[model samples]
Target: MHPYLQIMIGFARSGVLGYGGGPSVIPLIEYEAVKNYKWMNSDEFGETLALANTLPGPIATKMAAYIGYKVKGPLGAIVAVTAHILPSLIALIGILTFFYSFRSSPFISGMVQGVTPVIAVMLFMMALDFLKKGSKGLGVRWAMILAVFAFLLLQILTLHPGIVIAIFLTSAFIFATYRGRKTMKQNFEQESREKVQ
Candidate 1:
């Protein structure tokens, strides 16, 4: 099949099957892009996921757009975002209607209860994979520190995740840019001194 079609079908499939919400859907998207199609390696997918989290809207949609653009540019992005959203939108409308009618249904309630454990496990495994990737790129110590910091922010302090993320992004960017400029200035000074000698 063509690459563009793969983008549509992959995201559409994920949208259709993505139970719970955006976070739960990540493993599905990762599987579609990384495992099933070989569209990107795990590290590339991890980087995309990180970037997607920083964006304003839904993570899955952002990832779909990125993958589409990577493969086929603007039109591909449009196709991917549309396909990714369409299934969930339609399903939501239909489910809302049905659920309103069957709000007291024990089977539906039981199904939801049954799926909770599976979703938890999936999320845990995905988090582990991401942690491993982070460790590889940032070193184990920094990765552990980040994980501990995130846990304290969300679990203990009860801060909004967005606020925590904003703090981290802001500080990391400012410090990295400052350090880069400082290193460049030192290098330039050293070169000038050598030239004077």
Candidate 2:
């Protein structure tokens, strides 16, 4: 199959079935891109997800664009984004009108109630996967420390999320710089000792 068509199909599936909005759609997209399609490895997908969160836009759109571009190019991005968005757009205008009218029905209400728990579980599973991935890169000890700090700041202290994020990013940056310099200094000293011999 053509990459363009694959992009359309993959994203179209995600956009159409992605109930409960962005968080739900993300795991579906991850399954498509990382597992089924093999377009990106788990580590790359993790980075892409992180970058998408930092950007100012819908997560689904950001992910669609990234995956499409990776598969092909600029044109692939356009096709993927359009495919992803068009389903929801059409559904919103077409199907949702009927759904809205029947929303008060017991059947519709029961359906929603049933689906909500599934969505919650999906979100929880994704959160655990992402947490494990993050912990691997940051190391278990640092990851625990950072997680505790973030929870305290955001949940207990009621600090703004942006401020908490900035604090953590700065801490990570400083730690990285110090670690790099220490490694370099050790390498230099080792080289000098070898030269003296």
Candidate 3:
């Protein structure tokens, strides 16, 4: 099939099936991008997700645009974002009046309550997958430390997520630069010692 059609189907499935909101839609998007379309692997998806989070606006659309552009070009980005949001937009428009009428009904309340856990589980699983991959790169100890620190910032201190992400990103950059310089210095020292010997 054509790439555009594939993009439409993948994003449409994510947009339509994804309940709750942007966060909830993320796992579905990951499935489409990583698992279904083979557009990227899990690690690449995670990196893209991190980059998207640092940006403003809705994440799902941002991811859609990025993936689409990667696959095709500017036009692909447009198609991908439209495909991802249009389904949800049309559904909301069609159901808004009906949903508003029954917003307070017990049946509606129960339905939401039932689905809440499912969304939570999906998010939790995704988090775990990210953590597992992070541990592989940073070691389990460092990954756990960062995770705890992030949790404290987000849940306890109630810092905005964007702020927390910025802090971590800056720290990682500094750490990487320092480590690189240190390694180079060590290699230089080793070479000098070998020459003296």
TM-scores vs. true structure, each candidate? 0.83, 0.89, 0.95
Q: Which window of ten consecutive residues has the lowest lDDT sum in model 2?
A: 160-169
List residue ranges in candidate 2 displaced over 4 A.
153-170
What lDDT does the true structure give each of the candidates? 0.89, 0.87, 0.94
Ranking according to lDDT, highest score first: 3, 1, 2
TM-score of model number 3:
0.95
Better of 2 and 3 by TM-score: 3
RMSD of each: 2.7, 2.1, 1.3
Location of the lowest summed lDDT over 10 successive residues in candidate 1: 160-169
Per-candidate clash tally: 0, 0, 0
| lDDT, model 2, position 7 | 90
The residue pairs found clashing in candidate 3 are: none
lDDT (10s digit) by residue, model 3, range 35-141: 99999999999989998998999999999999999988999999999999998899989888788999989998998899999999999999999999999989999
lDDT of 2 by residue, 1-197 (tens): 87788899999999999987787899899988999888999889977876676667788999999989999999989998999999889998997789999988999889889999998999899878877987888888877877888899989999866567667678778999999999999999999999999
